[model samples]
Target: MSYLDTSDPQRPATAASDTNTAVTSHAPSDHIEMSEVVKKQSNGHGSVNVEEAQAQFHALARRLTRQSTQHNDKSGGDIEKQETFDLLEYLRTTSGKQDEAGFAKKHVGVTFENLRVTGVGGVKICERLMKCHDEFFLSPYYLAKSLVGGPSAAPKAILHSFNGAVHPGEMVLVLGRPGAGCSSFLKTITNQRGSFLSVDGDVRYAGFDAQEFGKRYAGQAAYNMEDDIHYPLLSVAQTLQFALKLKSPGRLLPEQTRAELNDEVLSTLLSMLNIAHTRNTVVGNEFVRGVSGGERKRVSIAEMMVSDIIMNNLLAANTCHQASRAVVCSWDNSTRGLDASTALDYAKSLRIMTDIFKLTTFVSLYQAGEGIYDQFDKVLLIDEGRQVYFGPAKEARAYMLSLGFRNMPRQTTADYLTGCTDPNERAFADGRSAADVPSTPDQLAQAFQQSKYWSRLVAERQTMQAEWQGEGDDPSGTKGQFLQANKEEKRKHVSRKDPHTVSFFGMVKTLVWRQWLLQIQDTVSHLRNVLKPSLIISL
Candidate 1:
């Protein structure tokens, strides 16, 4: 519903003019005179209800036009076609300038041809081709449509066509409920095939197809799913080393180079996610001694960052220049805001890095946190597979208030979003005044039950209990069975003779014989030496 009208720049102006003409023509003389006075005063003082005036004018014109004509079908269709063509042209032109040489190369010899044939011939040829290689011709969009039952079931619908181009570095938020197909939309953009749609829209990166976009831009865009950290059975240094090996390219680096890369990755990750203290700690199962929950999250993020860095470095080395752009998407469930020192340091470091690398980052926030809006250019609000709002974060509160929802006094964008999902409970949590509170306990209970907080907690507990019981029962049984088997095996083993006393007597007798042999050898050698000396003196 909240669509960007990027098409037809003259449409609004034409509508406004016609509406103004109709309104002025129909207004009473006294009312017209008063309107003139107000307009003149407003203009003089630089104050005007321009938007309302334009709307009123357009509405009046539309009413008059509806009464005057049945329909101009042919003209309307022609105008629409022209508009589409013009919009497409604008897209091509804008996209062309961004990467002129690339665009030229891609479109150089591409052409659409219409093959003429008598009905059945063309149909038969298409059928044969379809049967021959369906996989080759099938696209993600077509697959999604088939799975979802129809094109209408597909998540994306053109709300408003735009004439101007959407520039790079511009953030577009696609907000929707859990099952509203937002994830599908994203998947579509990534060219991931499945039963559901993730992202459904035309996306070009630097004048390349979606596949090419993935190759060129995917490395820059990091999509962090909401999953607990996976700690490998290794030390901190070993873990990073293995990660580097997996993510980094080429033969293993020299020891010094490896160490430097590791240190750099570790430091950047620590600064980015604000978890420097846990740099040396192991990240494994908590029951077996591992990092804290927050630290684990940071470690996972660090792994991702290291991957991106390696990707960028590889690309830079190949291209003979530095990679200058990056994007990251993180899904977090933590409601607590970052520490002040960490937040400040991150902001400063992010600015410096962005400047150094010319990075354009897009982070999607699904958790409750403060200052996230201030860091991004735009915020998109989606509810139930529809765009509720899309614009500046500062305007969000007013927009919600206009929708008959009360804004929390100290709530962040995430909190407000959560509240939107469950207004009554959020209101209660905020502790509304006595007069403003719901009248009955039933109402409050219903609100609380509907809150995401309660639902997520229940889900998490159920998962934990299931995992614990399943793992605990099997391990306990295995230990008991092993112990029983060991006892039985020991009892069945034959008893050995007591040989210690016999071995001790044998060792004493061997030692006495060796001492007697040594004394006789020493005396014989001394007598031989004395005989040799006496013979030499007689000669």
Candidate 2:
């Protein structure tokens, strides 16, 4: 873990924002190519002969490559040697590290630019009037499809000219109130495209195009939604075990090592999240008793923080063989319900994990406390559909001051910035009268663009992108920043067979044992539940 030597001469400081945060940029590059041999070996498909699968896979790869070349030529993108990854090499290195270290440095970097997302909001009342006729014998759906009548007329921009870069070992905070386009920004960056949304952007991960990032590099990035979803029937331990077993990189590590790592990760999560007491609690929903909401949010974080080695293996096993993993997690308002102390603890844990694992995390929180706010490496503030600011969290107040906005003395930065654009809070800072001061999100955005900070950022972006192509720009190169410092490390290698060492029978036995233990631990609660129903029936 301490293998990476980060004590080299400090690299040049990135663009300094008003908050003293460094802003860096990256250039867009090529797509990632998965080789036939690597693809075949990545997933454990034991039913077929390896040689035949390899041949078939190679044939398909050649054909696709040929077709892709023609398509790229037509699009005027040059046909260069495609960047390819070695599956065996990656597994040999990645699986062992993930098992022992809880995080495998995937050396992934994310860069997005000029992102614009447009979509129609809910149908207007006048449009709904047309839809009311749908209950009739002949559906308006035919007419709507033929003429492109309904949604086509109402399309509006949700995000316009959004831009940012997130490198590994950094936790970027996306801050905005409801409908300010923070969630949409995360979704567009992560390439979670939907039918309603029309997205235009250049998104790259680890130098590959975003489509490749989302498909082949499945585990490399994850979008954590606001709502935490889980099967309430499964206890915490059972749920975690199921995820680990199903997605574990098969044969990458010895059976014992994999098992040990799994235990270690689960235990660490319990301790970090302060949920050890509820390790066996069923993840109940509104219909049943279970862990509290704040505790459940921690569970969601744990799920996203699973080892990328196994995540990539899970995707590759499904034959979607462009390989990579959840090096980046874009969480949407994940700490909404937690108290200040708990949220601080949760944010601190994320910071620690990000440092150790070299994870690029994007979290959208509305009103974060000072403790949680200070933990962010960078901050992306979205106002309406425009980027209000993107830089260090600390310099935000100064940036605001330069923009004719004021932060009341002793007011927390989060509250001040969140409320600055409100019409009612207009104690103008830049000699403007309250009546003329910027109030709406749009006004704030305009004021920001007019400020000197905007010009500085644009200039900084040019320089940053120019110097980005060289080696060692990736934050992953800074080893032991979190996990180990000044400590040497050893390596372990294993086969595809090693990861698959755990069998179906083993899972069944393990699951049953875990379930029994959960029941035993919560015997009193279970008895009370059972007896309450019986007593009611008797009455």
Candidate 3:
């Protein structure tokens, strides 16, 4: 529950930002091999299984080295060992942190109580009118009339009085049928409250409150929409690199330059996510031939993961903390286009990052498998935006059964919980009548509120807030640690309040370079437009 500990030397001096965390670190040497660092870290940490971790790292290194050798043989030894060594070093960074203590990483947790989301979207267009054209005119007139009469009734509630907490290194699986407000809940937590007309509740990121968090650390905590969005012609590497460069910190780690750190982070992400093979392939749309649909989905995921590394290289230069800022991400059905195996891989990758960096992740998945489900530490079930269950993932099934719902044979727990939201899909236990059991979303929500789980959540939240925020005059917590880390990473010219690690001009320069690269790569496509206009003029 403790948010900040500036006194701890082992703890990374990391701070989260809306757009980025400007953390950097210094090393003894500019060219220190990560192999030596990993060895030192292994010797230092008593709890970690050094042999097991080293075995895994060595296996990956050997494979990558073999591949590099094979490619060099074909290309007449043009590729150097430096690039391969850098990639392995990046791999070691995440691997080394996996066994570290909580204080050793940039850690943060999110807690939300009485979270109510309301929007002006309960009634559908079809339901609003019998005629399409007549509806347009009536809709505006009805609104005007309602305004003239008096203050209107409160908007429909998309999510009501939901309470949950996700600590660092934990993942929460959000389960709900479509239109059950799953996406709304994710949007609210990741500081995308703009999507909803009203959000009434207390949401805290460590010691930072909702308003303060939204204003300061927006991109550090982000929500990834279900669909993928990228330039069709841009290669996967280019797409990811553009994001990495824009969010890059102003400072550099002593062990690596800006380019080396960026390369390391980028290579680590692509390798970990199993998309390294597609790094040079374009993320194509339906009209273009390029990487597979699944690879493109991974590109979206890698793009989001870029936020984690942006701060890693910046904090170590000036402070004792060598860790990057922890990230909290809410993914809305990110498995939309991915197959079952790929989805599981994606979930496992998330779990690894969550463990290594202490990331807080909220994933809303439809028809998630057991493997994928097992990765999450907790689960939240929503019925028409009303939370029916929120507790440990393993306890969700029993909690529902205690309420008289019968689990179908061969049905996965994920599906069974999802079925509880659908009247037609759920079955009641013997001797349990409709009157005896909670059937409607409202009744289910009320039942959950009365359960021991609800009481526990409330108690935990209150205790965490009290501990993190502190009582009495001292008022020591994350705010002080956050401010200090922010100050250290912040550049001289950048405004004190600005969240981005890179300056505006730096971002512009990077983006302009990207645009120029895009045009350079597709000169024929760019020239086509010019030639077409001239041909038309001549005709």
Candidate 4:
């Protein structure tokens, strides 16, 4: 018989701190059983003090202990097996029950036509020399060169004419070689265009134009960078708690307060990612020793998801019928630090979230296995900033094959699609020569323009644009509904037109609280820094 020991669900175990280490005597897929018990115990105790909550929790734990002991005695031999709790499963089952406001029901999709991104490249030494007209010796020569034909920085096209749509409940895998603009494409779609020199395209989120989406529902779109960044001194729990606090929505679920809801969501996130045990551990960097890189990556993901949920609370406040999708996320090689199995698991987890939340997601991966590749609904292949292909994920291989590209033995579908970007790496099909197929990036781009995939994308975009135009009365579109609901959820002081549920002062207070929490968490580190100047002077 197996038992899940949730003796202290609030405080995660610190016994196994290593990210790579598996939970002892528990299968990875095993579901924890404390959610029901916790719900029952806390039913009427929502406003209970910390001490009272702890007392009730301990009582529940003891009851579970007695039950396990009784089962062990009946089975004889005094042996028992414990199962690791599955937080994602608990959330999945309890999601509908807790937030009848349709937190998981809202959906958001993204569509872009003729999407192009351009950026200025770094200056070379030669270009720098051309700017040395005021320098000591070569003033005359540099001046002459500057007057004649000085090197000037030109905008390099990072992404050109990329057209695609990712609807609610669908995940698209962006397959491309390094520097193929996969990252740029993601950044552009998420409206992170500040770094780029120019971005020209028609981008809409749930029928809301870029300006409207940015002003009203920007928080609903998130971009998860490849690198993980965190405060090295703060524990995973502290970091996530601060994020939840700052991003806390104006309204609360049924009978729960803001604090209570944050706690519940935080616990669920920690458990969902199976990092509850490492909640107390610091998210260390190169200077400190703490959570492993994989765990840190998971923390980053968990933090992003926390932000997503806050948006959900605002978006799903009303209009459950129109809120099928509300979040659009772009993940840029988010599985970079994980093992193959963990990477696949991460994709599967995203797939689950995409389905359950009705989210529109875009993920870019340089190295993805077949399992991970199959998790996505669509595939967009890029080469040298040009979109070579965009269509269904399963059809990608066949499309590449139709383009006279050969799939090598044991090559994954993701690999095969990415290999199409490299001339030396990709092989030609039988009886196909370089002349018979599209070879260069331009050729591939041109070929894609001629393919049925391009036609389908164009047709889809036209239909969507027509529908959006027909929604002239409701200019904000589907996401506009989310924004309107969010407005209603705002405080009396907050303007109905204001996008944020929290006021300016509220954000400042949350930030100050975070700083205090950080100082308390790492007093030793703070003391060392504070005393370092004095120590140096004494030395």
> Ranking by lDDT, best first?
3, 4, 2, 1
CA RMSD for every model? 33.9, 17.6, 12.2, 13.2
> Which stretch of 10 consecutive residues in model 3 shows the poorest summed lDDT?
17-26
> What is candidate 3's lDDT per residue for 1-539, written digit by digit as tens?
11111222221222221111111211112222223222212222112222233233333334333343323344434233334443335434643342232112345688998899889744433235358888777888879976787444557878889898777777899999999999999999888987678899999887788898778666567889998888888899999898877666554443346687577667766765667778888898888778877778888988987876545432222222322343778999998878765565567556655654567889999978766776677899999989988888877877787777765656777888999889888998778756777889988988888887888888878887886767323213354545544544544477757776667887788889888877886786668868999999999
Error of 1 at 512 (Å): 60
Cα misplacement distance, residue 471 of candidate 2 (Å): 6.0
List, residue by residue over 126-178, the lDDT tens digit for candidate 4. 44544444566777876897789857777788988888876777888998888
- Candidate with better lDDT, 2 vs 3: 3
What's the CA error at residue 256 for candidate 1, in Å?
A: 8.3
For model 4, give the RMSD to the true fold: 13.2
lDDT of 2: 0.56
Model 1 C-alpha lDDT per residue in residues 1-539, reported as the tens digit of each score: 21111222221111121112111111101111113212212232111233233233223223222222335343343232232322112333544352322211111000001101111111211233356366557766567866876323323331211101112233334443454334533443333434433323344332334455454334334454456545333334445544554343222222225345455555544544545555565566655466665456555545655544432322111111111123333333221233432232233233222222323333344542343333343454544333444444445555444333455656665457545645354443233343544323233323334433334434543543344345443322322322222222111121212211113344465455445544664466568879999999989
Q: List model 2 lDDT by residue over 1-539, tens digit each.
A: 11111222222223211121111211111111123222122222111222332232233233233332323344443322443533334444455554344332354556677878898776654434445455463566666765875454568899877666666667788877688888887777766777445888787665667776555444445788999888676677767776665444433322236576466556655554556677888887787778888777777776765543223322112122222235678889888767655565566556644553456788889878665676687777777788777776767766665555554766566666766655565366545554565566666666666655566665655544544444334433322211121011111232222222245566576677767855675676678889999999999
Tell me how far the alpha carbon of residue 455 in candidate 2 is from the true structure, in angstroms, after superposition.
4.6
The TM-score obtained by model 1 is 0.41
